[model samples]
Target chain A: MVAKTRGMKIVHSIEVLQHMLNRDERIGRTVGFVPTMGFLHEGHLALVEQARTQNDLVVMSIFVNPAQFGPGEDFEAYPRDIERDSRLAAEAGVDVLFMPTPEEMYPQDGGIRILPGPQATALCGASRPGHFDGVLKVILKLFNIVDPDRAYFGMKDAQQLAIIETFVRDYNLRTAIVRVPTVREPDGLAKSSRNVNLSEKEREEAPVIQQALQKGAALFHTGASAEQVEKEVAQYITEHSSGRIDYVSLLAYPELTTSSETSREWILACAVKFEKTRLIDNSILSVFSKEFPTQ
Target chain B: MVAKTRGMKIVHSIEVLQHMLNRDERIGRTVGFVPTMGFLHEGHLALVEQARTQNDLVVMSIFVNPAQFGPGEDFEAYPRDIERDSRLAAEAGVDVLFMPTPEEMYPQDGGIRILPGPQATALCGASRPGHFDGVLKVILKLFNIVDPDRAYFGMKDAQQLAIIETFVRDYNLRTAIVRVPTVREPDGLAKSSRNVNLSEKEREEAPVIQQALQKGAALFHTGASAEQVEKEVAQYITEHSSGRIDYVSLLAYPELTTSSETSREWILACAVKFEKTRLIDNSILSVFSKEFPTQ
Candidate 1:
């Protein structure tokens, strides 16, 4: 049956999804997937829309992958609106909506861990022990289950995006990885479902995250050293925002390595805590050499 | 073209395989796979015959998986006879003889590392740091590429088999793992292509590995404690055989945990060194109360 704009199939089990996918006869149809935690925002919608435009079949999975979340790290508090997500995905012309629960995604007594090496362990991997392992495991699971021709991920989660790319390359996954630009709010705050949980005061201050990233990006253009750029960004966020600065540093883009000179591809990433919510943002920073005209 | 014996078609790449296994087609055929490193032997052929009887289409992959070998390991020295292997496989009714080069299998740069966790660090995992990681990586790649209904593994590599099972369970792989009993020589030496490296004297002493495991199994049958069984096995191999004992122990089957009293399922495993060659062997030892005649 064709999934209309309003009603679509929601598969909770990997087996069920595989069975359904196996029944579809369109051999040449290019499949696109957008894997997400249950809550949906305009940023997620943009990803779905991009997938819809690029692929014959668009699959949007709303799984709050438990593996990606650290213990006492907003797993339970993570915003989720499946009904609204379904409506939005349908409006975006999604063909399938995979909504697997933690139990459905992770089998009982299953201890298989996929560790994305150095790339995972540098930035977020340093802070979280098994974080990227969880991310890689779930993403690999989702990729296998969906068997998409192309998969889309937002650049907002720059480290995660990079790790996924490495996983696909290392494993020789057949799916193409399409990275979309980060979607932001009018006030410069990155659009996230978690932003909905912010109190009025925290919400007002959330814009400072984007502003700090912008400032870091600007300083990088002035041939500033990575250390100098980081100092300025951290100071700006501390002075203007009510949040506690978790970390602010300029590191190599995709590689996530700490580099001094603004050459080739690099990123200025920062994380800040506002009461209970932790927000993160990053921007590409590089020298405007022949290799990278826009940088 | 239909395979003369089973009417199954031979396919090489993922595209060809998936073309045959189209979504709308009725997959009435049972697909069984035997992934190998070419240089086919009686042991590898035995696995193929088992697959032939158990499945409608028997796919035998002859790829010397580079991911499984260390930098100094004999990946290049590993024997290969593809033309001869193909003839033998076809004689054994293999539907597809998948022969892929190292380049074809791992097209990407060798920069990235895929790490399978803690379970990989126990026993052999300790001996070979990233050995099992390479095995798991290549096997997972083959599993995804083949997408077989059932995959066959010989029991000769007991630890490797256990790791494969762990991978399938942990990754929620849909393929069924069909483990075959280890094929052996008349003198009790387990058949391995690597056995070719053994000199005449080493070859004669090779049977000692099997003898140690059998002795350990006998001890378990006599209601001996795991510790006692291990000591007896190690002592016997050391005193009787010209080969040096690498390891000998009675442990929990599959889990590899050391045990004193033989439980429901136990593994009497041993590894020995004959000159420069290393040989390993194990047998399942099951202990049942006298009251339970069935067990």
Candidate 2:
């Protein structure tokens, strides 16, 4: 169904989204895509803002992809507010809001999976198995349907940004993956859909996720070993937050592997369980690449 | 380097191919692609022919992807005759020959892998581990480089054709996968580049591969169970050929999974090892889909 707002067109089916994209392509319009799982956080908005700045038409997809959620995970409880999300998207300069049903995304026989490679095996991958595969599969579906010139993702999920970059490079997927810096609050907590799941007490403690990463980034900048940076982040999270620690990892940036490359950046990432909610955050541990040639 | 003959233009880089394809797209030209490893056979020509007929511009890529071969496999020994292949492709009505080096296809820091799921775990996938993953990875690279409206592949490698279809469906790949029928010699031997590796004795007996598939298809048409069809095919290959049997599998078409849908076709496939060389063949076992309701 085609539902219209002041600036944004809300499209529900893949057929309609593809049609709109095809017409846009024909008319020489550069479409930018921002894919999200509803909730409409500042991190997602930052992605949309980047998309809007870079392209003629900005398309946002708000589907809580079930394929990305693990068994016993919060797929059922995953926060979704389409009405609020649509209004936020419209206000944020999104041209088309694609909200597809799971059936529309999946086929009848069984669902499709975009299995991740070596890059998807570390950090969050360990605790949340098959999470990235499901993410990549649905994102690929969105990319094909929207056929955007550029797709935006927050670097908050630095591993995700890296995996998406690798997927685009590996699969020769045409979309340019644009990474927006992680959007955070004044206290430095990373904006997330799961943030809503945090209790008031957990919310106050969750900034420790970001504080730990910032601390690790500071340590990495001081020429500490990746192992040392990871240990300090883990220790800080365990001590400061009222949360059970899941993982504290330092990885080769974007590759998300334990391996290191001398001339590249690393990501210091951590995930912690805040009561029933899990919060994650990361920072560029170091910039030894050409981006920081002076370093 | 640009090599030209009549309507055929041969380009040596992915950049040039993409540029040409983009220019073609800008002018509203439809592109159809056929990707093959060099040592062009009648089967490859059939793919090119289909591609040429279906689209305004037909691009044929000849790169014997090293990624698809296992450690001891024929990556080094895989046949290559660029002059012969180029001539064949041009004669087959190919508009562009996008031949690239192996280095161009793979990255230095470990290449991209399109890992196959349940559909890839059976048939040839069992004997040749990581083969379909490589096939899909390269094909995806080619699809990205070419950006074809439709890409042609032969059903002789039914597993490959099925996997590609599944890949396209799974990944939401933009290019349509066109399956050409298995092309065979007068005696029913399916054309293959590796046929050169077959000994004269093996060559004579290789037709049994297709003959067995023909027998299997005949049995399948008679309402035989998938298991029975596989058994007869395996028995015929074992009895007649000098080759050691790798596998004789019959599974749901375009899925290659054992789980079948009522409105789907099955594929009877077999692979045999003739000394160091391997040969494969298949037939559409049955069709009960709505598309073939009369059948």
Instruction: Identify the CAPRI category of the predicted complex in candidate 1.
Output: acceptable
CAPRI rating of model 2: acceptable
lDDT of 1 at A47: 90
Pick out the ten consecutive residues of candidate 1 chain B with the lowest summed lDDT: B286-295
DockQ of each: 0.34, 0.40
Q: Compute each candidate's TM-score over C-alphas.
A: 0.85, 0.90
lDDT of 2 at A198: 88
Candidate 1 C-alpha lDDT tens digits along B79-193: 7876677778888788776766676677665245556555565556666778987788888777777777789899888778877887777676758898999999999889988
lDDT of 2 by residue, B176-221 (tens): 9888998889999989999999888989999998888888887777
Worst 10 residues of 2 chain A by lDDT: A286-295
Model 2 residue runs over 4 Å out of place are A23-25, A109-112, A225-228, A257-259, A287-295, B23-25, B109-112, B222-231, B234-241, B257-264, B287-295
Indicate the residue-level lDDT of B69 in model 2. Answer: 93
- Candidate closest to the true structure, highest lDDT: 2
